[model samples]
Target: MTETVEIARGPYRAQLLALGATLRRLEVPDREGRVANVVLGCRDLDDYRRVARYYGATVGRYANRIGGARFMLDGREYRLPANDGPNNLHSGAPGFDQRDWALEDADASSARFGLTSPDGENGFPGTLRVEALYRMEEDGLAITLSAQTDAPTVLNLTNHAYFNLGGEASGRTILDHVLRIAGSHITPVDADLIPTGALRPVANSPFDFRTPKPVGRDIAQDDTQLVRGLGYDHNWAIDAPGRAATLYDPESGRVLDLHSTKPGLQLYSGNHLADGPPGTSGGTYAARAGLCLEPQLFPDSPNRPEFPSARLDPGERYEHRLAFRFRTAGSVDEAFG
Candidate 1:
């Protein structure tokens, strides 16, 4: 119900809401010259709050799970609200996804949202100034997340956008979407979906996405990890630094190339997307309706020393870049590089 920003260029158009600095709509053209909304989202800001919490919002403080909802930073233990069973999820309830960011700047092709998180907010020890910048590029969107803290604390930020490149309301599930992850190893998780602090080879296993494969091809196989996540909700360590993964929809001839500076990516196959309100694209969402490619620090990075550190101290500026480039079948290769 507030003022929303719009970005348009070429055949792409996106609507961004200041509430949560969330992406409300993303439309691109298919091969047939017909445009379709590709991202899942609610009809209004109220629906976004009552139903799916993340949707197309920027999630943070710490983006993923932290074991036991607590972690030790510099010999000091920090306890966060247990939003996900016994673990901290998306920085707990009332997270950044629930806040309305200040509209710092906007234009025809980009928008900038800013927020300041005080020390002790979300149980993190820092007064952090943050920014989520969106820039519409030649064939895709680039998001830059940056932050600076006044105290030592752990932080990981990411955009949680559920995408169905076949067109969000095509009444077609994303099970047939082909995906290629840039990693051969994935962080295994426990029954509660918390990382077990071990990176296991996906070779010859159902977790293998080293090569291009359909999401539903091996999704129902009898596997412990799949059972725990209800589908695929694990993080893949990036084998290639600049590029993390790619998703292609053969039916619609749409492709998404993911390039990021983060070390890992959480590939979630919208297992719990049901019971949501009507989507902006006139579709009622259900489980596995869309998929998320969240590029960020490893889950529970603060607790697992083996993972890349997510600590930012006084005067230290944190910055990361992520881009999701959209292209058609024939131009996917050239657009990606």
Candidate 2:
């Protein structure tokens, strides 16, 4: 049987699932004190299994892509299952996101889920032990993903939670949401959506989110990058320390600020959400139904020699700290301060 846990503090609440340690639901109050779920979710665990979009799942043993489903580590080339075109995405099918995690602990304001990946699982080295911890704060939620490997391997973990500040069932796309990312450069990708190994400046390009603007403003442009990813599906090289990005829904006055310890942030515009499973609110989601702000190492970091390393050796611990603080536009200082 599947298990779920709910944690709350003040006006904030979150529902977590044991399957993939998924974030099933998140509730926070709007400007007028109206509370609602803000993250996209499936109607049930069965739907999550059939959908395969990674919705709200904890993705790993490597978070993003591995070029050609292979990477060289310590004089050995490890091969992985290629699921995303000619590349490996989210560490291939049956990835950490598709596993059943054990509910290790839970309380009124926090829950911890654990899982163990056998060596060679998904063609990844190391018998990895992992944990996904969700803690509810007065303002929003904090997710910490940590893992340890018994052998030399590559690891990058992150939560794939898509956000729609206006509410998940608001019957609207995130095109109107104003977004601001702290990075001035992005890891450009090729036609197959794998990083080209170059940190290209976002200046005067549709990829530039350094200044706040509507998500739909330049999304329809004929820019090559936009055409390749079908929208914004690239990783930004984070230049800030504290908060990495801010997403705001003007209509509802809801504001979400992202904080992360990772050097890269993947801004996926939910281009393929239309093909996802039926939503918890009852209906198939449309494109751009929500947007994902995934904090992790750059895509294909395992193959890029100059990228921030994703290598983990025996006795070494890997950790990714991600926090999402929600509040109304009028309470930015009160919520973050």
Candidate 3:
């Protein structure tokens, strides 16, 4: 059985599920004060089970991909189940996203879901305990993912929630949404979508989002990286740790400011978000219907020595905080000014 938890503050609200500790729904008021669900989600638990797209789900013991479905940790090579072609995605098949988390605690304004992955689970070598806390604060929603392990392990967790500021079921694409990422370099990927271990400059490429631009502006450019991922599916090695990215929908006047503690941000333009599963708008979610600003560690970080370490040892804790602030363009201007 799946349990639902609702949290709201002011004009912002969110609904969470026990399964995958998923964020099933998020409603916020637009410029005209009309509240609508802005995140893509299935109509029911059965639908969620059918759609493995990871909509609003909390992903992984190691989010993103692990090259060759294997990594060397403390000199021991551990192999994981290859789910995404030749790489391991979101830590294999039945990862944290597929597990049922326990509702450890909840209140009117906050909820905490916990999950424990036994040692050797998904080929990871640790008895990891994770907690996802969703708190409705001020004008935004804060999500803190923290974990501890009894043994040394590599962990990279993040929420895989797609956003469409115009509202999820509006039958609209996010191509027109304006976006800004706080990184000057992106970890370019190979044909297999795994990082190439090189921090390529975002300048002179369609991947640049430094000054804020429409997501579709140069998306159709004849760039090799664009052809590789099919769209913006690579990770940006963020400039700093604070605010990572910003997204705004002109039509709705809704703005989303993403602040994170992580070192990397992935700008996924919903390149493959098509087919199957009816959305909240009672229609099939089309390609590019939503986009994900996933704040996480660089993909394939376990194998990249130059990247920040994702290793967690006994008595140590791994914590990642992502704050999504929602407001209207007018309000944003006032706040900034």
lDDT score for residue 163 of model 3: 97
- Sum up the clashes in candidate 1: 0
User: Candidate 3, after superposition: displacement of residue 266 in Å?
Assistant: 0.9
**Pairs that collide, model 2:** none
> Candidate 1: global Cα-lDDT?
0.88
Give the Cα-based TM-score of candidate 2 against the true structure: 0.97
Ranking by TM-score: 3, 2, 1
Clashes, model 3:
0
User: lDDT per residue, candidate 2, 164-215, as tens digits?
Assistant: 9999999899999888899999999999989999989999999888888899
Task: Report model 3's TM-score to 2 decimal places.
Answer: 0.97
Give the per-residue Cα lDDT of candidate 1 at 250.
83
RMSD of each: 1.8, 1.9, 1.5
Shift in Å, residue 6, candidate 3:
0.7
Query: Which lDDT tens digits does candidate 1 get at residues 172-242?
Result: 88999888899888999998889999999999998888778899999999999999998999999998688
In angstroms, the error of model 2 at 32 is: 0.3
